[model samples]
Target: MKVTLKLPKPRNPLVAPARARKAGAHASYNPARKVRRTEKHKLNQALSGRKTEGSYDA
Candidate 1:
């Protein structure tokens, strides 16, 4: 019996960085959609309850 192995195609690395930059630019332009102090505090508090670490880092 003979067996053949197949390799996956390589990804286009350039596409990813370009897409990330575009997303970052769009997020920067839309200031209102950004998270506010109250929302952030609530999110942190909710996460603290579930996570033993108590806070999200970086």
Candidate 2:
């Protein structure tokens, strides 16, 4: 017979303040943040059809 154990989450970790100020209603969501974080070398679908040869990616 085999046994499995479920472990509890950890505690006592120090906390760090966010570098960016929290934005209210004026804040906008970047659809690209998800793609940039999860997938490497992949561009956000939101920007799949946009042009960037003007100044970026140099």
Top model by TM-score, which number? 1
Tens digit of per-residue lDDT, candidate 2, span 1-58: 9998998987545433443556476435776865576453334533674544342352
What TM-score do all the candidates reach, one by one?
A: 0.30, 0.20
lDDT of every model, 2 decimals? 0.65, 0.52
Of the candidates shown, which would achieve the greatest lDDT relative to the real structure?
1
- Per-residue lDDT tens digits for candidate 1, residues 2-57, read 99889899999899888877353544655555557655766777776863454554
Model 2 worst lDDT window (10 residues):
49-58
Residue pairs whose backbone atoms clash in candidate 2: none
Cα lDDT, model 2, residue 8: 92
Candidate 2 residues lying further than 4 Å off, grouped into runs, are 15-58
Pairs that collide in candidate 1 are none
